[model samples]
Target chain A: MSTYRVVPAGSVFDRFAKHIFILPGLGVLVALVIYPTYYLIRLALSNFDLTFMTKPVFIGLGNFIQILSDTYFWGALGNTLVMASIAVALEFVFGLGMALLLNEDLRGGRIIKSLLIVPMMIPPVVVGLNFKLIFDQFGPLNDLLQRLGVSCVDWLGNPLMAKVSVILADVWQWSSFMFIIFLAGLQAIPQYLYDSAKVDGASGWRTFRFITWPMLVPSATVALTFRVMDALKIFDVVYMVTSGGPSFSTEVLSLYIYRTGFRFGTLGYASAVAVIMLILLTAIIEVIIKETRLGKRLEWE
Target chain B: MKVKSKYVKHCLHYMLICSALVFYLFPIYWLIITSLKFPGDVTASPVVWFTTKLTLDNYRLLFGHTGALWGAKQYVGRSFLPSIAPYITNSIMIGVLSSGFGLLLGALLAYGIVRFRIGGSRLYNWLLSLRMIPPVVVAIPMFTVFRTLGLIDTWWAVASAHLLMSIPFSTLLLIGFFSDIPGDIMEAALLDGCTNLGAFSRVVLPLAAPGLVAVFIIAFLTSWNELLIANVLTTTAKAQTFPVYTTSFAQVERGTAWGPAAAGGVIGMVPMLISSFYIQRYLVRGLTMGAVKE
Candidate 1:
């Protein structure tokens, strides 16, 4: 048997060894992230518009107040919330279904699973552009629609349809992510439970509900957490496809922030928006962690 | 009857799998076909599914290649607004270097935390949290910081931004790998006249190589796919990454040249697709372990 022990408390040199090993990584993080985060908060409180000012003027909560009053900000927030929730919900359901299907003793299951992940691995920008081409007015999708005897619809031009287009593209790319996570969870379920359930004459649905679903909750929670974060911060796809156009209808929070900071040269206001997003995400994640007990599951050594 | 129903279920399962395969493969197939289509064929209404006339004009234009082998398409060289070679090279550099540095820093951090208990579990959580922080938030401040350091439009700046996400992820993942290494082996090595560094280099490193490679691949993919930081931080051709370069093809002002844009998309996607297939097994472990084991 092998004994496991922490490096024993020892001389100054030993203690220094640990610190020395850790410093390079932690130092880079502090200089890059911690320091900038502090500066971000400061910028949020100031008037740092590059268009008019050479230096940021401390304006306290001026930028936040401006953001609160701006209907565009509210619209972007609403769009982000809608996009994230809808996309994540759809991804979960479809991914769960796919995972269950793939778990069946079907020939070529491995290949199918591997092929499914291709969409998620492709660059998000390409995903947006790929969907853009597909959703073009004279593109294949609309052509298919016309052939199906349905009137051609403006996939990326109409506001409601544009939002749907973005969401569908997102779901297409990310459902595989959810599938992979769910498949792992499904595989990890002990077979004896299913065997006993079968012996008791339970239906497939019943077996899944009673045995599989509960066991897969941890992975589901994990998947949901990742999808929610990614969806909330969606930028590349929206920016590529629509650029938040059709009268600012599809402008997501991140896209809005990017435009404000980089396009409009309003760094201070953008920083405020960014800060608010961070806080909002943190609060939402905290609630999720509490509800799912996900934090408790971390075996962070 | 039950057996018949089970056969039906299997058929349905296979049907679903085929649908998924089509759904995933269609866009990629379309990108290839569209890239090969001539400019006029690309824009034809009722969307040309199969092009009667194929041309390498788009690829030639995008690459600024005037090779005689391409014949007439070679004559259309330098017509494309910008060549994609610089962007591709920049992305490759950023991906390779960031993943490289990220693995080094992450391994060191993971080893310290796992072996010596550097900052407890809280530090681990903090690192994971950094990955979740919206890149836009960091980009706002870091933009100015990079501007000050004269690092804007530089590969190092882009790589540094990518390191933000990759280092934390690589560390979290490597911590998992390092923790699995039997402590007794390290102790045995220590007793056999090996220093801590010597044990890591001689034993732990060799054992952890596979995991390290997996971490590097994941880091590379993450950096490769990243767009927001690269877009914000790099203002010039020198550091404009592939994703950013691809987006230029679809810029709203330009009316989207579909054939060439599709070519760019295919160019950007091929490496990722190939590499993702190679690392498919490790993908689940990397994603789930990082998420669940935290």
Candidate 2:
């Protein structure tokens, strides 16, 4: 940082070099993020005639209005929220438990830790497609249940189970991510904390509640916030597995937008949906980010 | 008494580990099993049980007979071909190109940010915020933009879109890496014949090799596994990736061809799974970077 360059003022090459990357970087940001967002909003507010692409009509809030009155939109929103809420909560509890287990000095812990991250590494579409096969009427899930002398229930066939099935797949892949974060946090806490607590006559439960839970919240917050944001935008799994389902039961917001834009060619409606999703997600993420290290802890990591 | 307490602790840890192993590994195990089974036998073994026969056809088909991907039959378009093979190649190509490009761009920007103290730090943090924003939010908008630009269904389109996540993640990691290289050392480089860029390219970069390598692998893996945008943006094999290759198995008439799809799924993930576990240390370091101070 203290390095001084004494190039004369007339050295245009160095001057260009100094500021060269700035404009290119800005250009990249706009092209990659800002422009696409702009065009999407434009399309959402515009008119699309089939024969000829119509001049974009300025229908103020009309698309949002249609979205508001549409029952499918509401259903999609509800399903998306339910999926995120359930998946995130499950991942938190499940991931916390998994982290605790992996932290143990067990013979198979390494193998288990390696195995745990396998699901997340799989492509999301494949995860959805794989689950699609698993959830079939005579799919392995049912066959397995039948083997246990229990009657098989319709998985994707039923409205509720479809959502539950996708949630389960998400929890399967991502709980490990949460676990990794918590494990890191746990590793950061000195072993002596537990030893000290024991010396102070703190019961195991008391030590866990006071030491583990409180100390781990910052890490938990990072993991949970990430999972929650991702779960809301859950598309690949839903789109690949159900394509919004037997009765549109599994159509989260992203799926709805995907269908609206690509399948039906309703660019404006899809754009509006996309924008709403972005705005809503941004608001939620901003709040969640507050609890994360970036906003709260204020460190590079 | 101390020995007894240690024994109880060990027992508790064992109990927790066993239950977690079973629960966490079940679904993935089921996927692998299903991939190895034929359609009829997919459910023949209990939902979570092992089947008597294990076949390798699913894995075989994706590796496909033809190397360059030729058309078996004429379809709607002038030159529609069997996508399964080409799709794999396309995915690999896109993954390599995008991640390669992303790494270069991310590293250079991260270097400038870290070394020169070029821009406001908040802007750098905001980039991390973008990293956190789910791709779904950007996917739809970008889909429209790409479509308009005639870049839809192209490799570059997908690659550029990936920058949205890769840049910020790379910067965040690189910032920590660069900062860890004490200011005194960078100043020493300037005292030599090294310009900021030269010093960065020659000295700082080599020093940050571990971080760069970790970032490269992660970026590559993410691009390889990406599905949502790829599925929407690309309709044909020309730009489609392996992740979406299985979706084509779902013909409107057929409910879903589980055998081929699961087989494809397995093929696609195997490379990633193998490398990740082998490089698990780097992956963990990459993920948990910025976490601990040097």
Candidate 3:
């Protein structure tokens, strides 16, 4: 066998090589990210509407003050929180149930997993449009309801139902995401732990609570964090289905921002709303990461 | 009694799994059937679950073959309903270019961090935070910058914005992959007179090929499926991606063209549906940004 040789630590290549690999990519990203953040803050503190024939006039705390009293802003924020909490909660429950069921010794499990992936893989626009059809007045869902001797519900026309419809569409697409993550978490637990639990005469519930739940916390935190972040940014589905309709009952933050900036041409005010959203999301995520110790669990150390 | 209970439980398990499958798949099925139905039959009161009178008129309209359709008179002046071909091309070009560039930069960055411990844990936290920034926040300011630069309605504009998404994601994923590569292999390559860059390109890259492909496909899908950034940056079919094109069907004054929209949705979803199957093994890692290793 040939003896192994070691490269010298003080080689010519070693001194400057890391910088070459790291700087270009990092520099491009930081520059791109930083400029927009700077511009966003500047835009937030000004009056920049496309309708007016004037440059952006800097007005300190003006947009923020306006937001404080704007009913629409509060309504949109409320709607966003409501939709995200309900949708993510439902997704988590259904996803956990499905993951538990799937972890059993069932035949054709592989095929089922592949099929489960189809929903989350489809584009959100497509999912939104498809759900819109299903929830339409004369669509399949209403027809099925009528056959069962129930009056057809105006799914998108009513404020509450429109919110429910939007949430349903989101749950349908994203429950699979939680399912996939939780399933991975479940599988990662060693089989011997379950066997030992069984030897101690522990029931299924106890086995899960004592052994599985604690082991799955890291995965749950990751999955929940990702889903919560996504749920907060809900736009395509709401835009396609309701356009935040029925008197803005389902107007999420992202849709609100889009309409304000693009439709109403209030770039400055929209930027202010967007800045608030960013800070709120960052704060929520920081709490999650800290409380769950997800940063450490993620091997970031 | 015990054996009977076990059998009952197994049956219950099968039933649950079957129903779950139906729940997940029914919407996709509904999309396809609706796309194939005649315009009148599409909204029939009883809901035409299946029809032998299936027609490709929706597809024809979406493809801009309206000149030959029987009711061509109705679509005469509707200039907004253009062929989806150009938008599809735009999406393909943008997805490929953005993800391709993202993979290059992200892979290099990931290698440096994993191998040399370039930035440490603080950098990792920063990258994760970047991933969490909502798209609307970025889109707002980028719109003004792009408009000023006259880059609005160009593929590069959308592609560059998508790079904001793809780079952090791909880097995070590649960091996981690069960490998995054995250090001894790289050392051996260096001992054999391979330069640092040479070892990465020739040895580390080949070993991590699967992970790279996985990252590229995911990044491609992210850019491809993205709507907000693409919508803000593109005003017309010149650089509009497929999702933007699909959303054009929703005209407020005149009711939405459901049939054609369904067809557009189908066409937009086909590539991803196919890719979903191809990348099944990597789905967990890719979706979770390597938080969950398969």
Q: Give the winner by lDDT.
A: 3
Question: Would you list the rank order by DockQ, best first?
Answer: 3, 1, 2
Worst 10 residues of 3 chain B by lDDT: B248-257
Q: What is chain B's TM-score across the candidates, in the order shown?
A: 0.91, 0.83, 0.94
Q: B25-48, model 3: which lDDT tens digit per residue?
A: 888888888888876777776788
Off by over 4 Å in 2: A1-17, A21-23, A49-55, A291-293, A296-301, B1-12, B38-40, B43-48, B66-83, B132-136, B250-256, B282-294
Global CA lDDT computed for model 2: 0.71
For each prediction in turn, the share of the native Cα contacts (below 8 Å between chains A and B) that it retains comes to 0.64, 0.45, 0.75
What is the i-RMS of every prediction? 2.6, 3.2, 1.8
- Please state the Cα-based DockQ of model 3 relative to the true two-chain complex: 0.70
Error of 2 at B178 (Å): 1.6
DockQ of each: 0.60, 0.44, 0.70
Q: Pick the candidate with the highest DockQ.
A: 3
The candidate that achieves the highest TM-score relative to the unseen native structure: 3
Report the lDDT tens digits of candidate 1 across residue range A1-301. 1232344434555547677669898888888888888989999999998788877899999998888789999999999999889999999998998899888677777777788888888899998888888888888899999999999999888999999999999999999989999998898888999999999999988998899999998899889887887889999999988889889899999999999999999999999999999999888876776687654554543
Residue B228, model 2: Cα distance from true site in angstroms: 2.2
lDDT for residue B212 in candidate 1, whole number 0-100: 89
- After TM-score superposition, the amount by which residue A299's alpha carbon in candidate 3 deviates from its true location, in angstroms, is 4.2
